[model samples]
Target chain A: MIGTEIPVLAVLCGDRRPPDMDAVEAAAEIRYTDEKGLPDALRGADALFVYDFLSTAVPGAWHAADRIRWVHIASAGVDPVMFPELRESDVVLTNSRGVFDDSIAEYVLGVVIAFAKDLPRSLELQRQRRWQHRESERVAGRRALVVGTGPIGRAIARLLRAAGLDVSGMGRRARGEDPDFGTVHASADLVRVAAGFDYVIAVAPLTDETKGMFDAAAFAAMKPSARFVNVGRGELVVTDELVTALRAGEIAGAALDVFDTEPLPVDHPLWTLDNVVISPHMSGDFVGWRNTLVEVFADNFARWRDGRPLRNVVDKQLGYVPSGH
Target chain B: MIGTEIPVLAVLCGDRRPPDMDAVEAAAEIRYTDEKGLPDALRGADALFVYDFLSTAVPGAWHAADRIRWVHIASAGVDPVMFPELRESDVVLTNSRGVFDDSIAEYVLGVVIAFAKDLPRSLELQRQRRWQHRESERVAGRRALVVGTGPIGRAIARLLRAAGLDVSGMGRRARGEDPDFGTVHASADLVRVAAGFDYVIAVAPLTDETKGMFDAAAFAAMKPSARFVNVGRGELVVTDELVTALRAGEIAGAALDVFDTEPLPVDHPLWTLDNVVISPHMSGDFVGWRNTLVEVFADNFARWRDGRPLRNVVDKQLGYVPSGH
Candidate 1:
């Protein structure tokens, strides 16, 4: 049964058909529209789902809202969507933090296997009608450092370990013990830890502290055979520094799924590098992803209706502060 | 303590410096040389370790005095090294079966992920400096039909299942209850079973029965989105038929590690297909693989000394008859 005091929701997204529509409908009186039309829809809304504001200019309508008490983002990272007005508002903010963990983790494993097994070279050989036999590295007994102890990082660690890799995780703060991870270290020790591993995976959320985290120094610290993989926010890595690392052989290779600039310009030098694998900020895009989003939204709706704290609530100070309990 | 009897050994290989020289010496009297030198070495040897040989040319070497009692093959497949004379002799033949399982399994998983994530398209987009966000198929819920329930096949099945895939294994005989695999089917039902799976992996040994196993009829029965992967012997698949199927889009794509012709002649058209991935039988080569082989040889040597039946004994009639016990 619909609650008597149904919370009104205004969805501001590029795609209106988010998989979590049923949950949104069950939790509140939801109205879906593009970001351009969001201001009109937010008039009496109690909550809002935002996605469109990341690429395009922020709409003035969101700033004028007084009735909207909560804002939930469909993405794992909310740095692009965060604005001065929204930050200053009393509205509660949340995000889809744990949803893309397994999908992105699987993508990371794919790239690692590709690089280690010389798959790209094999493809090139096949193109030339050449059968070349070459020895490739194995994943077993290799060291991996996962920089981010969130769901995505944990999932990557699990898969890597399953493949017989020795994986270590680094997070914002070192926990005494973690059931899901091994030897959790503080973020401050990431560069030192990076030097010891054959592969470094970045799955941390974007924040002021994480911005430019994988810069010149970080790459310089990695082993000459090490490969870097970023499935998190783009700004966390400095692209220019990464390009230099690939060209100079500071690191063996790199696979990037996110970029500081979307629709990377046609003339960018990164396009020409042989050792880099670039994707269109889409490591988490899997078939039926929309439906998965809908499921998360529905579950959150049930909690909202029951007057219980919603899951995946973002900390106002840090954004996506994973639950401690 | 050393054994009272110093057993004579014949090592027939292309390279004299076998990686397991120390282990070989510790086990028995070692006579190391290439295939051309095998005849002279065979006169005094009690056991033989053959890496490569000409089956038609080396018939007499297997029948020298019946003193050469045990034959150990360094490769997973004994086809190239196995002679008809040796098969008919009273010699015990054992192979390095489990040595390459993990390495080959890693390669299979790599190709599977590469196809599902549309990695080829991503690589092209990167080259064109385009940011195209497309939804990729996930391996999580996909069904895989592994044709060959050997160690390599089982290893591949385990890795695929760990990534959330539903894997079915097929073998020579259908077991009513096998706890290790899901839905074990007989090889005769391959064409019917091929229609429903997203991935078909062939790791069966080369035999008269398996020759031309994945032909035009098999490809025609497969789903349009299905992919074929062969890590087994090359003769098991018809190369021309595979080329035709790929060109006609009868199957989505294929990754081949072995070819009917080694060094896959420079002019073969199979190399030109963008959908196909080809490698020159290096999936089993990994760092420290030689050491693993040595360990296997050492364990087998101890068993042979104790008069225990060997682990990977190949059945002369059936060839690689799995221990029903």
Candidate 2:
């Protein structure tokens, strides 16, 4: 029954559409729709491709996804599409996980270096045409705690260690002798273990247990000279606590690519803080990333059509693509 | 001759005096003076310590150095003290060279990553409270041409390679299968070979042969997307040509730590350019760098007192501590 009839793939797109989708188009009948048209498009589709990974319309229109046997999102995190109805169903869920690993890893390393070298201050001084000299901190030999042990977090750990940083990881369970991260501390011990790192990078997925993991206590555990970087989901941190921590000098700086509310309001205090470096949630996006995202989904679609084991299959219970998959 | 009469050490200071000089003060009869008092202080001194490495008054006071046997500068480059008399005389010249290697290497990597990740732009947008998402480039697998084969350049090569860049070297002579840089291109071929790299980092010392090495021709030879970084002396670049190249878009961007002039005038055109990142000539100066510089000089002073070979003796004619020393 897998290939007996051509499967319909409902492609959910926002203002921007995925590029290089010829292969996906050829393999399945593609139904393109915006959020408003998603329900109609998904009425009898065998699969749903959430090209607009940022949209939260899926949960509201879940009733129309009755025939959706498989769902693929063009993003690493499944938070946007992990609706309760879908989680309870037998439908398979996959993501574009490995595609963003190295790219985000490079971004993490870049921000870490930026904070260490005081590059933001240099650029600001450059803008003022000032020639003031200041001593900068060295990135090498600094301790960094990567708060996720997934492929993306592992990639970051590898790159940071390569740049001479002592790297450790935070995961579901404490373990030793990990490949990329020498020691993996349990996520439950985040508050306790966070004190030892000069840089605490949050790359954990958003789940019931992980949401608001980086609160006032976590920031308090960090050294006043420590920096925080978040390339993970925004809700993984408490925004108010981070703001207070930064304002009171509990932490030295922060480089945030994601926010609880993106395009973070114009009057938001984080914009005015000299220590906070904010980007519009594009850490993993390299040139031609859209093409890569489409390719990942297309390759996965081919596998599904052939009744083969899908890549990056998310364990609904874990809320992510579990380890050793 | 060896620690027999307790050598008279003249320490040349500017507004800031060297800190933690207790050892040097105890080891010899120390005479501290500013530029104006330098000539009188050097009249009977057996050795001179150029604590203020930026001063050009050494040549003006060279006549008073009749009893001087050695001069140690607190800088990697000996450009300020490479006067004709010093180069022609039997006087030994030593510089603080190795101390800056890893620190400057980290700075070079930081700027490279800053450019690759568009961090400067992110900071600018953050200032304006704009959340625009842009695709950035990857640093890994990118080709880099380190235009100096000295310790600093070698350190940069090693660190960049660790960060996954394919690094080559530029030196006085071309060679293959080098240790840090796999391939070394001759400085003479910079204009021709500059086209092959994404980044060209100039860490060469200021010498007659290397002066103005990165001129208009070199800029024209590079890709329009290439970025130039200078952690070397300012005279190594033709400033006017660099300004023209930057304005005409011959090259994409430049991160200049050194310039033809210190405290680059208030209304310089380079400061107005959006593509240029200007920093004071302090890339190698890290936290506690002054202490390290002083320690280097103290250790060299001990070797001089013992009549043993100095650690960083500069080849006066070559203008730098040459490789294999």
Could you tell me which residue pairs clash in candidate 2? none
Give lDDT tens digits, candidate 2, residues A77-114. 99998878999999999999988899899998888988
Tens-digit lDDT string for candidate 1 (A155-236): 8998888777888888898764676666888888777777899999998888888989999999999999999999887799
Q: Where is model 1 more than 4 Å wrong at Cα?
A: A1-9, A14-46, A59-62, A298-309, B1-10, B20-47, B53-67, B294-311
| Candidate whose DockQ is highest | 2
Runs in model 2 lying further than 4 Å from the true structure: none
TM-scores, all candidates, are 0.89, 0.99
Tens-digit per-residue lDDT, B82-101, candidate 2:
98998999999999989899
RMSD of each: 3.6, 0.9
Question: Which 10 successive residues of model 2 chain A have the least lDDT summed?
Answer: A1-10
- Model 1, B216-278: lDDT tens digits are 999999998999999998888988999999999999999889878877888888777889888
DockQ, candidate 1, comes to 0.67
Share of the reference A-B contacts seen in candidate 2: 0.78
Docking quality of model 2: it rates as: high
